[model samples]
Target: MAHTPELSPSQPSGSLHRMTAPALQPTETGTGTRQTQLLARMLLTPAVALLFIWMIVPLALTIYFSLLRYNLLDSESAQFVGFENFRYFLTDPAFLASLQNTLVLVGSVLGLTILLGIPLALLLDQPVIGRNIVRLMVIAPFFVMPTVSALIWKNLLMHPVSGLFAWIAKLFGAPPIDWFNDIPLFAIILIVSWQWLPFATLILLTALQSLDEEQKEAAEMDGAGALSTFIYITLPHLARPITVVILIETIFLLTVFAEIFVTTGGGPGLQTTNIAFLIYSQALIQYDVGGASAGGLVAVVIANIVAFFLVRIVGRNLEA
Candidate 1:
């Protein structure tokens, strides 16, 4: 009789409320989720479309042009040539020289920047008078445009007869070296390194400041010398940043054209010609649009391969 007492309309049964509530919850949640997804897609559509227009369209046209025999110098319509353009570009002797020069430029710059950047970063991290001003002065080269930096170095710092380097050499009773003619690739590497060293130093200095002071202090207490402490503690902490620097520098290094274009002009033979300059030579100098298109695609492939490997290396370091 007690159990049979009628419940009030406002006081719903607990079991019925729990069952209905869960059922409504999933439905409401799913509807909200779908709306959020729709909104996200709508918001992303414009950027995705713009990206397609900018990047994909040019890439697609390059691919199409690679299959054609188009020449700026010729008045004839573009003719389909299959893969002959690619074959010709890959076999050109200039291409081989350019590839070699590219590798050497990239490797030497990476080495010099890493070797020099660490020390410079360490020095900047130390307590010094006018540290902010010194850091600003150090990073000033990075702000200089490639063309401008190339001109400055060519005219004011590396000129055999009148440059700053020449003046310094004369001060030391030595002849000024012909930077562009005798060692064009090395000169290119030096200019690029000068521009990028500040970037490396900035990143490394930030990493250094994050280092645990207690560890270094403890190492000092244990009689660990500066070299020993840096090698054992500091270097390992910097592995990730170094990898990041390598990845970023390699991407830009592969496409280094302005410095060579302004300074060396891929001149004194094919000594300083990298792949980017090679493409410019093919398209603008030779007027072979098809061959240049093929070269551009080849460069893209090469860059992708290098990027893939570097990304994998960086990923592994980060995970560790």
Candidate 2:
């Protein structure tokens, strides 16, 4: 009783898809690239909007408030005084000290990390027993929270009376040196360098692993000594990574705050105070919003300047 449907065995298997292909065409004008670009823009719109709200809006507010004499403690309304906050912040002697401390901290940590990380990375790269365990132990420091690490270094390690260093000093019949009190800036640098050293090592080690083995073997066959191989081949290979480490580390190092805040409290009388701590003192301790905002803007400008130069350097290295 049913009418038999004719089998179309000669027809292409994708015949249905071919018939429906026109329906799947993008509504947007132009070719595949245009549609893809439109889709990408649509996907990115939310992220772009969120970024503008999060970063740009606050920055604009900071700029606006920087122009006003706004003290959080003062009951009086904010009064507009263009460039006065900037002038005051610049003239304040603390700013100079903070600037110098910032530079020193960044420079010292960078130097320490690079100097130590290179050798550490080389050692880690070599085939050895428990190499994986050694790497894990070495990288463990980086995972520790900055505040926690500062506390550990301060109370457990550096404490003059009841700490590990004090015990070691006593064993050697040398009087224990007070770390934070005697050399506050150095203590901060040490703490920060400890935190960042693993990052440098990890990056350099990864770069080292990607190095061509044949080249090193060839160099050795040609009578290149270990030091010579390092100088001629390894160091040159590491140049780009080193620049990258410097650039990235410098950016975050410019805002070194937590270690100083936790360990030194920017103290023994401003010895460890950097730009970031100075801003915190202004905003929170002194309760001068305008001054803090101005300082913040100054920090922004300095960071931009540093980044500009760093980017130029990195671009040249990349080209090379």
Candidate 3:
């Protein structure tokens, strides 16, 4: 073979350069990493932008309308009113009643769901022949729309004459209680509780299943009874999930509108009117846009306050 020409000292051979140059590799890697980061940001931009617009636009408009003396029918009266709308909304005679009803409804539903859900969850978590079917049946109510559920309960179940509840009452020699007439708030609560019970049951059942078997075994070996084991081990395990359930339910319950609209129409003298229904009546029924916007803001603030307190409590529980 012909002797290879001597490589110049200033210029390294290709193989040598390729083998010895590690610095170039990092620059190329950095470029690729930067490109990946840029692409990731680009991909996320649209969703983030959409979310921001979706949340901010309505909030801004609500605030703007709340500050003006705007009525749907009277365009000439659309002038700045500062906090006057808020004063008017707050001073409305029905506001206090609505606020109280809203709180009672949310609190009662949470209590019932938690109390009933734990037992239901424990029952469902046990080994059964048709466990999947049972779970589906338990969770089926939550899938029903609020309007549809309200209608069913209002007509088929609590009709006070030919409804299922009335028939059951008659069979038991009890008078058929008119649910929406005599006890409108209770009727609303019952309807809402029925809808939410399934959600609570599902959440609690999932949490219950996540309990560590070894801990239970140890407790059993130490002569712990089922009740004691549940009080200690199971309840502690379910704390976080229960908090999550309560928080989520509270937020939605604060704004319950559809059921009241379909069933009571905030009627029987505003007995079943929560904050949401009150706002709806103001805006759509009364056509007082400014007052309704103010009420909506108030409801938002109340919800934020409740959520803040709940989050703080949950944080403490989580830390423990």
Q: Quick one: best TM-score, which candidate?
A: 3
Q: Give the TM-score of candidate 3.
A: 0.88
Reference-based lDDT, residue 100, model 3: 92
Pairs that clash in candidate 3:
none
Model 1 TM-score, all chains together: 0.86
Give each model's clash number. 0, 0, 0
- lDDT tens string, model 2, 180-279? 9998898788888999999999999999999999999999999999999999999999998998899889999999888888888889898999999999
* Model 3 regions lying over 4 Å from their true place: 1-24, 309-320
Task: For candidate 3, write residues 1-320 as lDDT tens digits.
Answer: 23334522333234444554575685665665567768888999999999999989999999999999888999787999899999988988899999999999999999999999999999998898999999899999999999999999999999999899999999999999999999999999999999999999999998888788899999999999999999999999998899889988998999998999999999899888889999999998888999999999999899998789788887675544
List ranges where model 1 is wrong by over 4 Å.
1-32, 75-77, 310-320
TM-score of each: 0.86, 0.87, 0.88
**Candidate 2, 136: how far from true, in Å?**
0.6
Number of colliding residue pairs in model 2: 0
Give Cα-based local distance difference scores for all models.
Answer: 0.90, 0.90, 0.90
